[model samples]
Target: MLIAFNKPYGVLCQFTDESTGPARPTLATFIDVPGVYPAGRLDLDSEGLLLLTDDGRLQARIADPRYKAPKTYLVQVEGEPDEDALAALRRGVRLKDGMTLPAQVERIEAPDLWPRNPPVRFRKSVPDCWLKLILREGRNRQVRRMTAAVGHPTLRLVRWRIGDWTLEGIAPGEWREVPV
Candidate 1:
């Protein structure tokens, strides 16, 4: 079985959280399907499409970086990105780990998305803009780091697409069975 889940912010990618702090939300809170596991991870702070599958081979294909499955995000970033900044992102930005694979990035109008709980901060002086970023690599906080490297820190990150699947009809905290 394959599932496309719209993961909400503040929800852990795993089924459980072992930390000693106050109880935190996790996949288990939303997904109750037995034997299904997340194919790839979406950070606790990031929101959007997360795939889960019961088939190991299918999960590997979706999650493995070697497959280069394209993941698309609509990012809200601080400051307006100039052409140079966009070019840098398109050409690949150097991060602490290494230079990332060149990404497909473009300035886009703010997407119509569900409101984030607690909401992204609003600044009166600093200009902000939206970017459509498509990447083939999945490194820890890569999008946030890349934008920061280009002098535009990400304010909000939302995964809109992964490979052939999308968050089209999935609402936040909702999941649906999809064909593999």
Candidate 2:
């Protein structure tokens, strides 16, 4: 079985919180399916679609960088990017880890998205814009890093699609099972 969960912001990707410290929300709060694990991680601050599966082979296909399954993000950035920045993202960007693979990137009008709780901060002086970025590789905080490297910091990040599956009708904090 495969599951697609629309993870809400501030929720940990893992099902358990091992630490005895202050509690933060986790996948357990939204998902109750047994024998399934997240295919790839979404950062605690990011809101988006997270795929889970009980089959190890399916998990590997989705999570392993070698498979190169595309993940698409709708990003709200702190500044409007020029053509140079867009081209740089399309070509590739040098990061602390290594050069990122070329990504499919384009400027987009703000997506009609559900309102985030507490919401992203607004700045009058600093203009913000939307970007659609598709990457085949998942790296730690990669999207945020790439945008910052191009002189535009990400204000909000949402993963809309993974492989052929998408958030679609799934609302935040909800999960739906699909056939593998």
Which digits, one per residue and each the tens of the lDDT, describe model 2 over residues 1-180? 999999999999998888798999999898888888999999989999999999999999999999999999999999899999999999999999999999999999999999998699988999999999999999999999999999999999999999889999999999999766
For candidate 1, the per-residue lDDT at 38 reads: 94
TM-score, structure 2 vs. true: 0.98
Off by over 4 Å in 1: none
Best by TM-score: 1
lDDT per residue as tens, model 1, 33-135: 9999999898989999999999999999999999999999999999999999999999999998999999999999999999999799998999999999999
lDDT computed for candidate 2: 0.94
The alpha-carbon deviation from the true structure for residue 21 of candidate 2, after best TM-score superposition, in angstroms, is 3.3
